[model samples]
Structure formats: C-alpha cells, structure tokens
Target: MEGDVWMKGYFRKRGARWSFTLDIGRDEKTGKRKQKTVSGFSTKKEAQAAAADLIAKFEQGQYVEPSKVTVNEFLGDYMSVHYRSSVRPGTLERAEHMLKNHITPAFGHAMMKNLKPLHFQRFYAEKSEAGLSPGTIKGMHTFLVTAMEMAVTWELLPNNPARRAKPPKQQQHTISVWSHEESEMFLQHAKGVSSYYLIFLVALYTGMRKGEILGLRWDDIDFEAKTIYVNQSLTYSLKELRISEPKTKSSKRAILTPVHVLQELKKHRLRQKEIKLKLGTGYDNALAEKYVFTTSKGNFIYPQVLNKALVKLCKELELSPIRFHDLRHTHATMLLSLGVNPKIVSERLGHTSIVITLDTYSHVLPAMQEEMVTNLETAISKIQTVL
Candidate 1:
C-alpha cells in the first residue's frame, strides 16, 4: 500500500512467501495507472521487500509481450508478401522446401522480437557439425537472410538476426575431363559399336551439349554450306519429349564444322538416306522428328538412356567412367590445348561470354603461362643480339 493499495493478512504455510495488492487507479492530473493484487506472505519485512522489487521491475522497460510475434508468423508474412511473386517457380519451390524442412524447425517457435544473433550462430554451427554440407547450409542461410530482410522492410523486425552470421567454408571440387588418348579410344569404340558415331564425332568436334546434340535436325544443317545452326534444345518436360528454344540468346549462334568433320557428315548423310529408303513409306514424318540421335525405332533419344549406354561402353572398353557431360569437357580441353582462342571456343560452346569460358577452363590454360615465358625469352634474346 505504498500509494493507494492494501496489504492482506500474512501466511506462513510455505518456507518463504510474500505478495502485495494494489488499487492502481490513475491520478487525475498524471493520468497514469495500473492494478495488480497478489497477497501471500510469511513476514511483513519480506512482503515489503518483495513488493518493492516488483514495483522496480514494472517501472523499468524490462518486460516484453510474450505474444508480440513468432518466427512462424514472420516467415508466413515474408513468403506471402515478398517471395511468391518475385522468384521463379523452380527457385521458389527450393526455397519453400528449405524453409519448411530446415529453417522452420530450427527457429519457428522463437519470438521474432526476441530472436538474437547468437541463436542463429549456434544454429549454423550445430548444422555444420551434424554433417550438412557447407553449400547446402549456405543456401539455407541465404534463404533465411532473404526472408528476414523482407521482415525488416515490412517493419516486423528492428534488425536482421542473421547479420554478422558467417557462412560455412565451401570445399572446392575439381572438374575432370578426358585425356587425348582416352578420347581417341572412346571415339574408336563409338565408331565400331554405335550406329550414331557421327553424333559422337559432332560432339567431339563442335563441343555441343548432349541436349543440343539430340535436338539437331536436318533443316538445321546445310550440307553445301558446312555450317550447323544451334537454335533449339531437346528436353523432357511433362513426361514427354519436347523441343524448346535455346536456354539463352547466346546459345542460338551457328558453328562452322571443320572440313575434316564435313567429310564425315557427307558419309553420315549417305547412310541416313540408305536407312530412309529401307524404311520406305513406313518412315512417317512423326518418325522423322528429324532427331540427329535416336533409337532403332526412330524415337527421340532420352538423356538417361544415352548416359546408360555411355557408362556401359566405358566399362566394356576398360576406361575409367566419366559422365556423358565430360564429352563436352573433352572437346573444350582439346580445343584449348590446340591453342584456339577462348573467344572462338566460347562462341562455339554457346557460353554467354569469353570470361565464362576462361573461368571454366582455367585449369586447362596453365600452359599459356609457359607460352608467355617463351615469348618473353625470345624478345630478350633478340635485344641482347642487337646490343
């Protein structure tokens, strides 16, 4: 009853207990008021002390509303208001899965206003220790920060909890391509066993992606011109084979086939004509989907089916197994070894720019350093002779 309250009768039932009651009515001039009544005490001194401490705490701004906001609520608001419209469908699906499976479980029940940097730090450390790969954890961290950033923009949080949270270090993995000898062996094997040896030759010579190889049609090739146009790619979507425009504008450029490869193309064309005549009128236009690579039934070749064949063939030839994609890598590697300019290789490979080509094939270009040294040595020798 410091201001306008009452102290009820004391009790000694428990070891030590104290409580106070309050009227808490506002002073008219001040218009400030509060009311709480708690009455249980073993001694008057203890009750007074306890009441004083309670009043002190209430005076300070140390208390917070438990139900202010939760991480779950914030996540919902973040996704619905910001992410759904901005990201692509595939990217959104990955984000949604990451949040639901990884993020929400770790921080869902936490009060948004009370979330701290230490909580995020501990969570990231524990995830790393649990054997989650750094790249995967980094992806989750990116999603969380992205969502919380939106929360800040919407005024739901004062600052991002993920600030200063360091992402895990990623391990560098080297990409491997076939050696010259291995490529030659594989080409010979393809020539002897696969009816589509020209397909393999074209891939080795042109550095086209597997999808691009499968998507090549008769109209895209000009026999007299010795040029192959790459304007579309084959992909499986909706459980059916479909042809779609190249993934990027840069991927639609034309490539000039080497004269040696042109000779092979002429032979392959004659073989195709023989096969078409043998099939007669039964060779329907639908059957002529004009695929450069296909099965005996003339059906569009699936990537998985081709990959299986490549693996089986490698095992039979006693060669170390390399992914079908490595065929393209082999092509790029050979061209760089031959001292072809990266700009020309980049255009042929349909990369967006030379920088991308150089970055991807940097390991293969270390010989260029020795070439530079040779040039420098020759210049120095010429200057010394003149002197």
Candidate 2:
C-alpha cells in the first residue's frame, strides 16, 4: 500500500523489500517530469526516510538532474556562447587548440554529472607523466575549471569537481637575455640590412610587446615630447590584422624614448615617405593606416615575419640564436643591471607591479648585491681611517 499524494511520496512492498518513489517536479533542463526512485529498502520507515531526504535536497535547490550532456557538448556550447566574445582572438584561438588537442580527447565523452575529482586528478597525472609541462597543464586546468564553473552556474552540477582536483605544480625556470654588447652588435648588424631594424631597436630600447610595436602608428609617437604612447596592440587572426586595446590597463602607457632612438625614428619616417612617393597610388594605404612600421608594400608586418628575420640575421652574424621576444627581456635585464629603479623598469615593461619585475629578474640580483656590498665596504673603510 502507498500514498497517492505526490509530495508525500509513496511506498510499496515488492516481495521481500520496500520500494519508494518521490516526484521532484519537472526537470528544468529537459522539460521532462522527474522523480527519485529507490528500491531494496529493508523497511517501509527506511524507504519513507530516504524519500524525505530526496525531497529535502530538491527544496534546498541542491538536486542536480541527471544529465546526458557530455563534457564535450558542454564545452562546445561554452566556447560558442559564453567564451568567444569575452576574450581576444589570439587567446580564443589558443583556448580552442587546448580544447581540441588535449582536453576533448581525454574527457569529451564523459557525462558532466558523472565527472569526479578523481577523474581530473588522473588526467593531470597522465598529462604530467607524458612530459607535458606543468604550465601547459595548468592552462588546461584553468580552462576546464572555467567551463565547469559555468556548468555549476547553469545548475547542471551541484558543484565544480574541477575545484577539488589537484594539478601539477608549476616549475619556474631561469630566463635568458642578451648582454648589452650583444644587443648593440645585433642592432648594428640589423641596421645594415634588415627592413625591421627600427622595430628591433624599439623592442630592445623600450621593452614594448610585439603586438604593441606592430600596432604603433606615426601619430602615437610624440617627437616633441620624446614619448611613445602605447594604447593599442595589433593582433593577427585568420591572416587578417586588426588593432585592439592593450591587454591590461597597465599596458597602456607612455614610455620615454632615448633621444638617439627618436632621431632614428625621424630618419625612418623620411625613408618611408620617399618609398611612398616612389610607389605613387600603388601603395596599400588602406592596409598601413600610417603605421610606424610596415612592409615595403605598406602592409602591417606579421609577427612570424619578425621572428624569421631575427633568426636569419642571427645566423648570418654568427650571434647566439634567441627569439625576437628575448629582445624585450634584454631591455629589462640591461636596465636592472645598470642600477635603474626597478619600478621604472616595471612601468617601461608594462608589468602590473614591481614585484613582477623583481621576481622575473631575480637572477640579476646577485650581481647587484655584490656591487652594493663593494660600495658599502668603500664607505666603511673611509670612516675607519678617519676614526
């Protein structure tokens, strides 16, 4: 015998066991009527207690409907709807690659509700064992956590299992940079033959990011003030270049350039003007937008082009091979080595805080410490002689 009222739940005897069923209202996700049913209870009271617990969970908004949606399905929807518009094109592209190449292969078919912290722990362990860097695994973890948080928001899961999963610890490695002498030599060699000589010089002198340098326009440079305004970054996606605001508020700044660098920039402008005049109406004015640096045809230069040029120049000059980005590091390292205030270097590098600058260049500290001790020893010696 059982009660007919749905809220009160019902119980019936099935041979040797008591069965209970509680209607928990319609599933909002599937638009289907839902219920919680359990069999094999030893007694009617036990069955009734189980039914009451299920009802309490429903009333508390903690009940998650069993969903057939796979992690892949949720991630697909998340990317298309929740994530696409909020991030930069380059970032979005990287996220997609992480999803397709790593995440989707591992957990795509697993049901969202069925995913557990153990599953993710195993995933991280496997990725670590396979020789993937902890930083890359951390990135994948971040993406998964974000997606799962959205699932929690949608009430598809009671909580984000990703929050409980542990990923491998990130390992910090030493950063490499060019010496001042090496940088000067490279710039000299670049000026002799490279069309991107000014771009490389700016990177080394100002520490502007690749995107910021590529986005620079003639108007953003103030010759009178000897400052370059970093307000935008040029990003490439699908073979098309577009200007976007700087990555962070700190990224938008005014950097004072060396007088010699500005003088060279003035020369560069004159050279560009001469080329434009020679091309007449054939110049790609629509693509250039008065950009401070561009291809001979007046199109914005791609990042890959800069990297290839730097590689070729280094090989030709028999210089140590380093990435174009190492130039920015070279700029910061040089400033720190010269006893320039770290805060000033931080601002020039567009870092959010001086702590980031200090941490990133901690390797340079031992040399600075030695110089400080030497200066202190000299001062103390003078005082001792006087005494």
Candidate 3:
C-alpha cells in the first residue's frame, strides 16, 4: 500500500475462503453510501490485492455500481430506447430477429456486469464454427459494441466488454457509381430505395441502357420465362424518333429478371391499366403493344424525359445527379465486384465481347481477383438470424 493511500476496506476469512469489503462511493441517484463485497478468494493477499485495484478505480471515478440487469434486460432497453429511433424499420426488424433467434439464447441471461471479452469472443468463434458468415458475426459485434457503449453511458457497466472482444474480419463490400472512364468522382451510395425506385431498379438490376428500357414492349417480356428480351431501341436518329435495332447483335439478347423486378413490373402494368381506363378513348391503347412505358395520354416516354426525371429525383433526395444511363454502369460494376463471371455479365449487358465488358468495368475486377482465392461468394450468403 502507498503511504498517502487511505484504505476504506477490510479483509476477512470464512472457512476455506477469504473475502474483502470496501466502501466504494455513494449512489448518484439516492445519495446513499455504496459498498462491495468480493468473496471466494483463495488467500487474504489475493483478496487484499483485488480490493486495492477496485479502490483505485473508485477513487478515479472509473468504477460503476454493479448492475443486476441481465443482458436480456439491457438489450430490451437498448432496442426500445435506442434502436427504435436510431435505425430504419427494416434494420430494426433484422435486429429484433437477431436478438430473438441468435443472441437471446446465447448469453442473454448473464448479468451485464458479469460479461467479459472472452464471453463475446467465444460466442463469435462458435458462431463461425457453426457456418455463420463472418459478415453476420461482424454485424452482431457492432450491435453489441453500440449497446455496451450505451450501457456505460447509462451507468450500467464500467466499460464495454464487446469493444475489447475480437471478431472475425469480413471482406469489404460496397456499392458505388463511378463516372466515365478516367474522369471524376460520382455518387457513392446509390442504393435505389427511393419512392421512384421501381424504374431505377430496372436499370440497376438489369444492365439495360436508357434507350433499351424506353423501347420495351409488352411482347418483349416473357412472364413464363422470367426474361426481358432486348430487341429494339428508341433512338433519336436524324432528329426523328425511330425504333431501330440495338447497337450490336449481342445487344438483342435475353436477360433473366429478378423476381423483385418482375413483381414491380406487374404492379406497374396494373397501375398503367388503371390510368388507361380512366382516360378511356383519349388514351392510345394501340401503343400498349409497341411501348410498355408512357405518359398519362399513352405517349411514349422518351430517353431525355426519363433522364430529366432521374436528375430531378436525385436533387430532391440530395444525392449526386447521375443520368438514367449511368445506372447501367453501376449495375455492371456491382455484378463484377460480386465475383460474377465477366462472361455472364457481358451476356446480360449485351456486350459484343467479354473484352468490352472487362474494358468498361476493369476497375471493379481487382477486388474480384482477390475474391477468387478466398471463394467469398460461397461463404457470404444471406445473413440469417437463425443459428
């Protein structure tokens, strides 16, 4: 003990065990004196040393009163008081599912103060062993780190146990839109989740150009095949609107459509039908076979009109102004980065050769090259909350 140290603790023994008692401080809420009793030490020296360490923490204002709140109790408070307002509805739902299915069963009953780095580390390792992806473990780690941080702010814990824990590192995955080759920076986080996301989804999910999208016809979509056949493009040639062949022979290929996009397309068709019925004979029902998208009067939606709409929508959302055509580049970049075969991406994008696809999206290929050794595609799938 130091000469200036004023010890406020005592030691005792009960049968084979040694114990120590210390007056830590007063409760901030009740203004009552607080004491701690630590028992089950093998020797008086060990008890004395432990009590001395705790006294230093108490004097330095780093000690927290022991909380009886279990991990479950604190997680409930964290979700209601913090997550409900802090995260989006989808994020909140995912978090709730994680808590109910994965976290609660693991160590939710353990007292908050009793948690240690080893507990979290072991849990993450066990999860990885059970075939849960590193991404899921990383997400869970982030949640706990945030929750434990809040627990410290609320005086429920001395420090964050999760912050000291080590989690498995996952690959860095991000979606961004780049400008024209070797030009300048463009939009970084274009997730296509806005109110007008349906049309944007078509461009981003399929690598179809604005002209190809504008020229889509009811005959081109095969509902049974779940495919969108690209045959013609609405081109403004010689200052005249003309339905011409695609830029290349490969551009007239068929691309498989995602179910989400197909469902949205069906809904869009229904809305279009309702508008046609309202207009009656004023609408050009004849254009239904020639054009899938149109104005209220069933006039064709030109490429420039769609471009203007995209620019205005980006401004309203405070996002970078990307033209309707840029979404095609974004789609190619995302697929290439995901380790999808370049040849397959070329076929979907209607590129004449895989070399052209490579030349255009070469920037996203280096990361995929590394992914080849890691085989991340097989490992990183849907991050299920189920154990």
Most accurate candidate by lDDT: 2
| lDDT, candidate 1, 216-240, per-residue tens | 8878887678899997888765456
> Residue 24 error for model 1, in Å?
29
Question: Looking at candidate 2, what is the lDDT of residue 83?
Answer: 98
* Candidate number of the best TM-score: 2
**Model 3 worst lDDT window (10 residues):** 181-190
Name the better of 1 and 3 by lDDT: 3
TM-score of each: 0.64, 0.84, 0.49
Cα error of candidate 1 at position 171, Å: 1.8
lDDT at 213 for candidate 3?
Answer: 83
The per-prediction CA RMSD against the true structure, in angstroms, equals: 9.7, 3.9, 18.9
Judge candidate 3 against the unseen true structure and give its global Cα lDDT, from 0 to 1.
0.79
What local distance difference test score does each model get? Answer: 0.76, 0.88, 0.79
Candidate 1's C-alpha runs over 4 A off are 1-130, 139-165, 223-225, 236-249, 263-284, 379-387
Local error of candidate 1 at 255, Å?
2.6
Clash count per candidate: 0, 0, 0
